[model samples]
Target: MGKISYYTEEGLNRLKAELTDLKTKGRAEIARQIAEARDKGDLSENAEYDAAKDAQGLHELKISKLEEVLANARVLDESTIDASQVSVLSKVKIKNKKNGAEVSYTLVSEEEADLKAGRISVGSPIGKGLLGKRVGDVAEIKVPAGVMEFEVVEIAR
Candidate 1:
């Protein structure tokens, strides 16, 4: 119903591919599983059939959600992005105000957030606080642990 905002072109394509997979490959797999289970025994008391039906329901739910995402997805243009401030799709380098430890994070969409890969969702607490911040600005972001402050060291495209 609402827009599915994305940070990069690649991320949008990935979502589309996932949607296609769910519609095609995923559907085929579920159908096969259901058919196999159906062949096992009587429908009323068949545990395998019940389990397969449940799996089908869950798979359909995923497909529905994926379709919604694909319908609303808007891919961001990389060339038009301004690097003067911390914004979505920007690679931001920040320094901890208290500890002075520096780290770099690529701001992305919620679906693309991978902490291990240093990609953070723009809607996240830290990312929300960092948005629109220019170099030398301090972003006071609240986390589950406590409030942490990060100084914007650099913003890159």
Candidate 2:
């Protein structure tokens, strides 16, 4: 069963754009490569042909996977998301208990998860621990190192 993916309006648009690029532009590029390989020589012992076929297979697989994800995607209403507590689409501020360091992250869909952009996937360790938490609440997350505590400083939509 395909899991439903929740996404913001911009996120959904980005996914759609990616799907289009993969299906059209990507297909054209791979087809060109395949044709070039085919023109090289006899197919019976063509390593280039084999490599092209493999690459095409990979490209098709990626397209299929993205299509499946798009089929099950559900756009989230950002306005409906509560800023009172940490949840999907919520920007959460947390203070690391051990280091006294503070970090802010926005919980978003896996597709939109970018650490450099401060967006984390809901399934991530820190994200999971932060979910459903409110301001001033502490979440004890278990990592490979050990259990680390974090205090929820704020939450925003």
Best TM-score among the predictions, by candidate number = 2
The 10 consecutive residues of candidate 2 with the worst lDDT sum are 76-85
lDDT of 1 by residue, 1-157 (tens): 6776774778877888888898899889999998998898789999988988899999999989888877787888877778788789999999999899999999999999999999999999999999999999998889998999999999998
Candidate 1 segments exceeding 4 Å error: none
What tens digits encode model 2's per-residue C-alpha lDDT throughout 34-75?
A: 999999989989999999999999999999999999999999
Residue 41 alpha-carbon offset, candidate 2, angstroms: 1.6
lDDT of each: 0.89, 0.93
Looking at model 1, the pairs that clash are none
- Give each model's clash number: 0, 0
The C-alpha stretches of model 2 lying farther than 4 A from their native spots are: none
All candidates: TM-score: 0.95, 0.96
lDDT of 2 at 93: 87
Name the TM-score of candidate 1.
0.95
